[model samples]
Target: MKKLKMWLPFVTLLFMLAGTLTLQAQRKQGVTLEGYVYEMDEDQKFPVPYASVSIASLSIAVTTDENGHYVINNLPARNLQVTARFLGLEEQTQEVDLSKQQVLDFVLLVSNFRLEEIVVTAESNKAGAATASKINKTAMEHMQLTSLADVMSLLPGAATVKSDLTSVTTASIRGGSSLGTAILMDGAPISNNANMQIMSSAIGGSTPSTSGTTPSIGVDLRTITTDNIESIEVIRGVPSVEYGDITAGAIIVNSKTGRQPLTIKFNTNPNLYQGTATHGVNLGKNAGSLNYSGDYSYSVSDPREGYDYYRRVTARIGYSNTIGKWYTNTSVSFLSALDKAEPNPDDEQDVTIKRQNDLGIRANTKGTFTFNRNFFKSLEYNVQFAYTDRDSYFYDEATNATVAYSLSKQDGAVLSSIQGNKIYDVNGNLVTNVPAGEESFIAWTLPSQYQYDYTVDGRELNTFAKVKANFAGDLGATHHRMVIGADFKSDGNVGEGKIFDPLNPPYRSVSYSDATQRERSYKDIPFVNQFGLYAEENFDWEFANRHLQISAGIRYDHVLNFGGGLSPRVNASIDILPEALTLNAAF
Candidate 1:
């Protein structure tokens, strides 16, 4: 009987243990995943189709449908890793515990350059190359950039200054003038070195560039609005040979393409108002896609106060497609802008008076082609046509415009004698008057009273074409990447200025006061053609399974107008504890 009781207790314990395990297994929860994948288009978000979704733990995978909806069932009740990937977008991963059904959404973005967390020591296009800084669309939205000039101030080693009188915005980099810094949209350069002004006797040579009294240089960014910019990159380090005419640095802008959804946005503040709309449509696998965008912005220093404001309107359309190993992208855009400024009545003066009514229009077409299985890697071409018309004049609100003076005597003398007030001409000559109270009399201090209007017209055309090829091979134990490219560019400008002359006497306006001012003009049209050929070779050797890396590159460039030169760059990285610590140097 003693033996039977001992055995019975052991059997009962085993049964209970088995029953507990069965109940636990039955109580385990199931995992089901349901969510959508979205792609961002400026300020709007829309679902994406055919995104690959996979779970590593369960060995299950699926693709999102046309509506960007995905559902996966029958996953284990444990922590699982899920990965989502799409072409032309950054891959994303998520962690989910299958203890219950989980709902998760993913957003994907596109970028021209990708870095997986590496410190840059030298100039390169790859990860950890040079001092390249990128401003993505998300960052652009957060910063609320109003114009291209605002972007320069955000970059390192660059300073921006705005002219309060002329409403011109320019930038200087690393103590260098704006002329040395190159601004490029896409792969082409658009530099404006001309300062349009009425080059005639009535206005004299009062243009910012030609006048010793004012400070304004290079292209004016105040007229460019930030509606269609997808991203911007600033290369602060030694740039590649592909970029030329730049002594300081370069700014590259990439416009939005057609791989996005439709979006609309409205933004406003006390001094600024903006509206934008963008849309994209997929035609077919063989036909490609279409994209369109429109943006308008109106900015004022103070809406309730003085006349200091500008308006910009821009529109863009693009098409992109891929067939076999060939991919093509083509786009066209137009810009219209106006900048105006009026000085306060008290601060207005004939010698230093500046009131600008600037108007401009620009149109450009750009096309790019990439070949995946060819000796030539890519080809790009751009054509730009633009015109600027300005009607700026010095105005005197204090004087009436109905005055008609006799041609025999100077207007200042006649007016002074009629008003019975002693007035001085621009030369400080004293005058005495006998009559009093004339309605049409204007003081000699009013500059606008002597001239009709100052007008300037400018037209510019630019074209760029380039071809690039890359080679990758092995040299001993080191890997070599070589890039070779050639580019040709032409820039031409034609403009006419009226009523401005710099060589005239100091008292020129007053000297001709007795005669009706006849407009004197000048024309200066400059044309420049630049051809460039460049080659770069990069060699990388690694030790200890990539724990230590040494990279070096040398570049040679031949510029048709600026001559030729050679630039060499070197970089190294040592991983101390894998992802935890890294030591790097570049020169």
Candidate 2:
């Protein structure tokens, strides 16, 4: 049955070939013309299934689908003409020189614009112009977008600047740098740039080949569960004031809600990172929804690029009111450096080794409060926080040099080797299996770190907030449907590195403190604060029974060291059709 199924198509093709050959021999005339038709508007936009095309002579024609896509087969090897016509639209004709088994696509134009002075509006596909915005609800629903950079890379006016952390998170918008782009979760800004986003700062020790950071402010993208997201709004350019100082773009994500009924979902699939075991369920009173989903998986593969096999795990949970006005979202995810590929630390040595014992965590939470519609006027406010921490030990740094190493500790010699280790916590809790030096081998140093050693329990925090009005009045004659707003972001990191300095020890010997190299340690905490305001508006003009719309906005930002800045944006669309297809662009 399988073989027959596979050969059926070929058999049909062979029969068609034989028939064509015989027919050509019998009557010197044999021709087949085929093509698909698209009814385009005056602006050359495909209106999608609103028009019809047909061959008047032979009654052969086909219409397109909602996506403005179609395919027609069996065309001729000679010249052919096609006529396309739409109701309440202009009729058109096309001529083509057909070749053997060819496909032709068409673009038709409508005579009149779809939106005229009709005195009434049907449904707002979210616009008054004849052009439509491609709402990709399904696309967002299927992809678990992890970074603001990843989301913006696929949008217009923006190109993601990638690096070592592209998979973890790294991005740039338009001509602006990654740090220059404003990022927001809900309506609040995301800050703590040095850490909130991962940076490949060296692992400060003898083994400086690997990279990582102490517990610090990092964006937690894994917590955003696709199943829990209601919608993800991507603004590829400057957005409205209801936003803040972002010159490039912004992404507004709305989480799903109404958790009265219980539901469950799960998956078990093997991937490059790990095999996944995911589960999601909802539990709440009859009035609201409280949902939770978690994932645990393991992955180990020899990537062609030689990224040694390793492991990872992800999980999240969210809660909302079914009948009340309160909501909360909280989740945590982890990535332990199971292993990696590395080059030998010696200048004369050329070998790759597998590294292990790297670990990190990310956690976030968002809480919201919505007041009543009357006196409270539907006031709603939200807050979210994120964190990431990592630690590892491998050749951190190496200079070109060679040394002999056979001296004893008593031979007035000093020799030492160093390995890197890390302890990290996300949000507020420390993760497991961290190697903290023994209490007896502890000491203290300050400001920041490297040695003689002391054990530390540390934590870092980042906070974001959002506030919006259910109703906002227009500001003046410009139709400034103004949604005024501000954002508050804060980041804090505190910890110390233990350092071990030599003390008149043996010179050029390997047995001196062979297992104990940390000398002293100290701790330092750096925190940052930022704020901004934003605005946006829309304008429309009617001419020749068509509408020309212009959308514009601006943002103001105030960072700590970078001072402050303002960026403006604009988008326009002209109604070149009757139904709703516009020529749109934003800059």
- On lDDT, the leading prediction is 1
What does candidate 2's lDDT look like per residue over 358-381, in tens digits?
Answer: 334444555434432221113445
RMSD of each: 20.7, 23.3
| Candidate 2, lDDT over the whole model | 0.40
- Tens-place lDDT per residue, model 1, 1-587, is 45445445533543453344334433442457789988776877788775667653222456676677877654445556688765445557888766653888888765333354322222243422445676656555555666777776666545443312124676566667787777887666766644445334433222222211111466666655566676677766555556666667677787765456567788777777888888777775446677788888777777664466666777788776544334455676676665555555565463333454545555555554433111122344555555554545442222232323331223344544244456687999865432344444433443333333234444445566666654333333444344556777666545554543321212233333343333333345456666765555444555565555444444444545656555555556677777678776766
lDDT for residue 286 in candidate 2, whole number 0-100: 31
Error of 1 at 470 (Å): 2.3
- Candidate 1: residue 580 lDDT (0-100): 79
lDDT of 1: 0.55
lDDT of model 1, residue 530: 66
Model 1 CA deviation exceeding 4 Å by range: 1-124, 153-167, 194-216, 343-453, 500-524, 545-587
